[model samples]
Target: MSSRYAFTKTVKELRSFLTRAYPIMKKNNPHVPILIREGTGALPRVYARYDLGQEQTCSLEGLSDKQIEETVTSLVKPTSL
Candidate 1:
């Protein structure tokens, strides 16, 4: 597959995943703002910007789907108090 296709696909999938996750995140971290942005790469180069200043670049590139899911979930979701 072309690099562009891969990147687009990755971001699209990530968007879908995040849409489902947003409600849960809002409930968990209502005071914090969460946003996901596409990063530079052919693969899933996605970043999650949390609150206002904290940013988390997904490091799940080249990993399995399950691993990526777990990584994204952990990255966007805040730790328990």
Candidate 2:
């Protein structure tokens, strides 16, 4: 059996997150690819993948689409000062 079936609520939440997150994530960081993935928390995690396939996950739990848009901007920003 798939976890998707076993955890319908989680699946629903995850879907809701991705639906809202995809557009905002793309607009904020168009240069690189963004990924939304399943996580240990209530909300899904978003990742920014580098050219070499390295990934860094960020949280958007309980965040509205507008909030996600703002927050994801920060996540993809240059880590170095």
Candidate 3:
């Protein structure tokens, strides 16, 4: 997929996953930044910004396994899509 498409998909997936893990994620009065770095000739890298009192990069390397599934689930739900 293109960089923009990949980024969109990744962010959507993250949002869904976070919502499931933290029921109040959508209402967590905090601004989160999701960044995607597209490789020159390789797969894109996903990054997430977390400010749990301090800024830190979330360990999303191995955490996106469920992203596709969660994203798909959310897409099917009109209210949550």
Candidate 4:
């Protein structure tokens, strides 16, 4: 998976790739929680976590398309340190 994103070279590459991927997934499914894997707590890494309940709500609830798009976009964007 890392190789596909050209992140196989190093951990930094992997995190960068995952950071970019996160928004695409969130855009597709806004309600699901995204879990980023990292070392213990001090250091962070990118990862995906899916909850079925959240998925169901996103699918069934009345969420505007615009809102969903914005939310997903926010998720994928890099955060400030």
Candidate 5:
């Protein structure tokens, strides 16, 4: 995610959070693949793939790091009953 847009600060925060969280995410979710692309003209978004070709997404455009993390954790992390 590039931070050149209007929501630069939030996006940067997200990027930094992802940088630190990526490894932990991978370790916890070994079967999941996380792809991070940095470039211009790309909206901040997260995609989670599940069985049967199903996919979920969350827009991170102007969200703070905490919000981003919450959204991601809810999407990717398995919850206990």
Candidate 6:
């Protein structure tokens, strides 16, 4: 993945996850930039930017705060293979 990521904020149910995960994701992965977009009325989603302009999108419509946090963390700080 590239050194950046983004998240969408349109639903009230995602507020807590976005708030808590965003900061921790920033702190844990200082080299990667984190971005947030609000008021889009889009379905909750997480985006991971990758090399060669490739990107990945994941749905977070039904995930809890903990689940969302885990998903974001995994994307931002992937395990070394």
- Flag regions of model 4 displaced more than 4 Å: 1-9, 40-81
Give the top-scoring candidate (lDDT). 5
TM-score of model number 4: 0.34
Relative to the true structure, candidate 2 reaches a TM of 0.44
Tens digits of lDDT, candidate 6, 21-53: 667767877898777776554667789987768
lDDT of 1: 0.64
Compared with the true structure, all predictions reach lDDT values of 0.64, 0.61, 0.45, 0.44, 0.78, 0.67
How far residue 61's Cα lies from its native spot in candidate 3, in Å, is 7.2
Per-residue CA lDDT of model 3 for 1-81, tens digit only, reads 576676666555555565575445325534543333444434323333323443322333223648544543443334511
Per-residue error (Å), model 6, residue 37:
0.9
Q: For residues 4-34, what per-residue lDDT tens digits would candidate 2 score against the true structure?
A: 5535654565566568777876797587655
TM-score of each: 0.54, 0.44, 0.33, 0.34, 0.78, 0.65
Tell me how far the alpha carbon of residue 30 in candidate 4 is from the true structure, in angstroms, after superposition. Answer: 0.5
Question: Ranking by TM-score, best first?
Answer: 5, 6, 1, 2, 4, 3
User: Against the true structure, candidate 3 has what lDDT?
Assistant: 0.45
Q: How would you encode candidate 5's per-residue C-alpha lDDT over 1-81 as one tens digit per residue?
A: 454556677668888888888889899879766788876667878888877687888898788778888998888676432
Report the Cα lDDT for residue 4, model 3: 66
What candidate 6 gets wrong by more than 4 Å, as runs, is 1-10, 77-81
All-Cα superposition RMSD per candidate? 4.8, 6.0, 11.1, 13.8, 4.0, 8.9
Output the worst ten-in-a-row residue range by lDDT, candidate 1.
59-68
The per-residue C-alpha lDDT of model 5 at residue 74 equals 89
